[model samples]
Target chain A: MNASEEYEIMIGNHAAAYACKGAKVQVVAAYPITPQSPVVEKISYFIESGELNARMVRVESEQSALVACVAASATGVRTYTATSSHGLMLMYEILCWAAGNRLPIVMNIATRAVGAPWSVWTDHQDAFTVRDTGWLQMFCEDNQEIYDTNLQAFRIAEDPCVYVPTLVSYDGYILSHTFMPVRLEPQSRIDDFIPPLKHHLNLGDMNVVKGVCPVTTPHVVKREEGTAPGYYEFRYSLQRAMEHSIEKVVEVHDLFAEKFGRSYGNGIYKAYKMEDADIVIFAVGSVASESRLVIDKLRAKGIKIGLISLKLFRPFPAKHLREVFKDIKTVVVFDRDVGYGYEGILFTELKSALYQLKNRPFIKGYIVGLGGRDVKADDLINGVLRTIELEKKNEYVEQTEFIGLKLDELDFLKKGGKVENGR
Target chain B: MTEEKDYQKILASVQKPVEGEAGKTGSWSTIKPKINLDKCIVAKMEKNVCHFCWLYCPEPIITRTIPPRILYDYCKGCGICVEVCPHKAIEMVEESEL
Candidate 1:
């Protein structure tokens, strides 16, 4: 441990706030939501106490919060905000706007389940809902990872090769409310790690009057004066930025490890005990962290199993997943959220990623812990055992099944032991 | 890396401040607003006085000066200046009449 490093017991929300403070974010625009409020609240306190010289703009709603961050980030300043399920839903329009404009605004998502049954619990639905919005998404396993990922998010988002906004998400109550010891590097080292943001567009400059995200033709418009790229070209460039960010993610992770002595795999996903395993358990966030215990238990029983905890979700990291899962025989995905009409979102996406493989593994997905339900190690073990049994019996396994559900007790739907769920 | 550097040079949609972003709306119209210097308030006063046509012009093509002139490049023939000119100095004249 470095002499300049300080270890303190803090919740994931406070860790995110300290990350924002350490990065010296210039503007914080946010509105309050459960599980995400403490992050912005602590940032506001930092601003109030003059520990961080930054502007705190408390807007009416999450939409305006992101909008203000977009405008502030366009001015070449590092900006931040926090939101949850409904709040993220409110900011969906501006989320695309931020990405389309290539603004490097960082936001922490305390991942919560979207409501219809009015659930205020931890889930992946909130993060998965806008997976195609073109933002770089990272999921954290614990408070320490929450802190490290948040700091790394700023550098990754503002990298010249990738001027895309970033979302650092941790499970709502699991990480946000739970306290853990996080090692924080000194302010000078942090400053050296993440310098002031030098964004592409600076709307704050008065000398240069500029128009941003204006409507353009579907194809390039050429005239006697000059040539202007069309909307398609702009979108292609954004996609390229997303693709190129994978390298920057690894580069920044290595640099951070060199300076702060903390690393998470190659910054895309972290693997545990995959050297000789034929079957791998795939999960994200707290569920993946919890599965480490399950791995230990299963390993003791002479099972050839491992765990692949995904850190980066967006841009899918298809290449890396494909590389890691090439020799594997089976992959069992545990999701805290379902894709509603389809199976688990990660399960479908992982299948899509491995579609091109010549000898693909048999993959099964199980939905577990929706709406803050307690995800027990026994349940995870049972899920893994069920998958292994299906493999041994040579039976076609179901695509998605709910884990730890009290289906027998429920009187709503019981027709021959099969409930007609989603598509 | 060189390829990446090349992509970084020309990013997504950001345009410098330019006039006629929608491209010279004057060409879209058959008529344009014409101002008579003889009756214009600013023109007659010979000093920077009331230029209602310049203030109310939606396209804001009218110049704020002595004998205020309408910039025909992007006028769009809106006739807002004609209705706004208190002294009846502005009129939307057809191109054939001009």
Candidate 2:
């Protein structure tokens, strides 16, 4: 379907493809990985069917796929790519290069579980691992937000003040596979919204002298006046850029709503049932959307509970969250994934963000629905109840709890197991 | 903070990948190549035509003079001229020795 059509029923991957097409991305180089493969497949279909005018490079590996996009973007072309967990891991090297070079490359990630035993389920572990790589990280909760955010990502990333690469991540099967209604904006409106990409380095002309992070560095000084900055200064610029990015994100989000009549809580977060509420549940991705149902159910039974869905993950939206949670008594964070040797990654980030505030709430972390396990409304309520019960005590509540786990079976293994060590 | 008597050369821009304009890259070479003109190829071009050393040098400073003189200012001492000399007319001496 053309971008002129507004409403249609499509899966999340197809919605992503529609956004890339509407943005008129010039180059798409992606490797196939499950859950995320459909996004690349749909884009390739658009290219092959003569509907979307773009070059689709089917690379051999994820590293090559991102490098190809980096190369195309170096010449000032808008580029796109998509990948799942292990595929995202494989691209770690070039991913850092793309962001470090400030290429404004837009990529979609179908967030999935990383493998040791190899399970293809939705999780936030993959995205959390690369949060510091200098790309704008956005977590979308539904198909419509996925479609809209992908469209808006081009404007936000290509903004001269914030020329950092942006990653749009949605849940693996729950959102990527499920059919949902999405509204596609008109092509002219999208073109009006996001203009042609302008390169900071302007490598389009060869005579200007260009190389991607040239070698032989440590004090091998170029007598030329514009030698590269010290590594520390280069990284410091990115940190400053990240600090300035939240303003651009809000501007884009507000402009998008003004043009098409939609709102996403000023592009940082969406708070539900927060009015006159004492406690709130915080989550990201599909879990955030799922919590809405639980919030509605709890509010009806005289429960002063609210829900806060994180729309942007990176640059962590600290100020916005600090303002929202100032009055709340407790915040129950469901991570759906764990950070080794610590609590949930999002939970850790939340506590750290809220630490400097005047009236900080008692925040609790729970690892739930890992590896695609069902996290129903009832399961979420149990976690919330545990937090409430712990609130009335003078004792310490555990920092992290793994919800819906078969602890008895694991306990049996711990109590009565043979210790065979190749003797 | 002690940079050899507090010398700091401030840069005007962040990394411009200057091509042939990066002042005299020959300072990058550790081994200075000394060409022996008695057996040089381009020096004996009147006797026979062989200038492989000039053709194979990766730097722009190598020229085809009577003895195919290597410009030490930009030679970078990369020994390619020594290795590519058909007549075995060039030898790489350590820069300290030179």
Candidate 3:
């Protein structure tokens, strides 16, 4: 077999681990959480067997794990870490700090439902909650995309125009634990693709330590000199870096496709069979894989249906989404988590993105799979079909609906009614 | 050894201030610390004390004395001595006024 030939694999976690190793990540900071534990475990074994020369730092908390990586990256080392759900939440405050200070660290997040009833199941809520934390967020559709996108994430995040952290998320328990065929890129090729990191600003150097603040003073003149262009200047520069990442993401994706044989689609949004469809479904994560199968089945029966899988969520890709959904009459958004008082968070953002456009689709937000509940292809098909039906009747539901809810055990409550189970 | 000699030469060049501005004259208009004998705690008591102003100036702007005074031309107005002086003997008077 040729070196370019694909080597199929069975699990997303294994594929992610292989990609990290293939990228020659120098340091691995591992803290175990459900569904994300296997990613670090596989890397640890590889390190012990001398397959990789990575240092695995066993940290006490997710915060310290990220801090350790930040410290290591500041020294101009390639760093990698993985976390899920509560662990991702714990690393929230430092996530902004890392990006603000311009550290290039790559992290893998296994998308799990945040707790109330406590579940280790699949959902995008955990990653979505930190969407505004200044990290480049990418959702993977399958095992191959999971493996290849992780490599691309490093290149994109570390690029000079976009020196921010990145998080590649795969659905917990669904794509993460499930086995699938994934092609591996040669280690040498990946090494050539991602060069060793060169940091522009590193701490502890004599110039940096002495030049940062020569002397501490409480004088107004000295204070103004020290903090000129002040706090807002720092935050504004970070925002500009994130906005600039939109172009860098496409450039790196194209470069990676040229070097390797695989391609992660273009234009920020990937449309499947949406050319002439009157109704389209917008979703992300492993659920998009299921939506694809449903779209294929619906298309065979002569129904005009399609699906738009959101790949990059943080930059939101609003302009690209508007162009894609321009002609469609209705769009049904399947969200894996609820925003409590509002509809699905993605649905709210999508609506706000399309609000000012003269020609826009009527969007319906559906909250599904709250506690790792499985969202089958049939469930998605039914939701899209109902959305089409509502459009045909010229009737729309202003309130969001929870699909696939088991209502046998719970009683319905009115606006002014006391629940029987209440204390 | 060669590098050390080069650095010392650079340091020696900076040590000599421009001529015609020598000793309590010329730009002796530049405020040099003036010790007040009456109000100074150490100068009045004739003791080796009151070095707070000397120790606190960020730029080494305060000249060490029984009660220290400031060299204003080089002082960047950090006001460390003004805040640190226990007897409030030091004031950051304007360089132009001095």
The numbered model that scores best in lDDT is 1
Error of 2 at A38 (Å): 0.9
Best by DockQ: 1
- Over the stretch A1-423, how does candidate 2's per-residue lDDT look in tens digits? 555465799999999999999999999999989999889888888899998999998789999999999988887889999998999999999888887777789999999999975989998889888888989999998899999999889999888778889999999999999999898888899999999887665466756754333443544344444345555555666777778789889999999999988888779998888988899999998788889998988888889999899989878889888999998899999997899888899999999999989988988889998888888888898988888888777345555688887755553356566545323
On residues A125-175, what C-alpha lDDT tens digit does candidate 1 reach at each position? Answer: 999998999899999998989899989999999989998899999999899
- Candidate number that wins on TM-score, 1 or 3: 1
lDDT of 1 by residue, B1-98 (tens): 46555456556566653457678877889998877888887877899888888788766677788889877878788788888778998888888776
Show the colliding residue pairs in model 3: A9-A182, A10-A179, A10-A180
* Candidate numbers sorted by DockQ from highest down: 1, 2, 3
Regions of candidate 1 where Cα sits further than 4 Å from its true position: A1-5, A209-214, A223-225, A411-423, B1-6, B16-98
Regarding DockQ, does 1 or 2 come out ahead? 1
- List model 3 lDDT by residue over A1-423, tens digit each: 963456675688888999899888888886899999999999999999999998999999999889888887776788899999989889988887777666778999988888866888888889989988878889998888989899998888777667788889999878888898888877788889887776655663534432222322232122322332334545566677777678778888888888886676682667888778987888898777788999998898888988899988877788778888778888889999888788898899899989867988878889888778778878888888888788788787878798888765455455555588643
Q: How does model 1 score on DockQ? A: 0.27
TM-score of chain A of 3: 0.91
Output the lDDT of residue A226, model 1: 66
Clashing pairs for predicted structure model 2, backbone only: A227-B15, A228-B15
Give model 1's docking category.
Answer: acceptable
Q: What is the DockQ of each candidate?
A: 0.27, 0.09, 0.03
Residue A302 of candidate 3: its Cα lDDT? 88
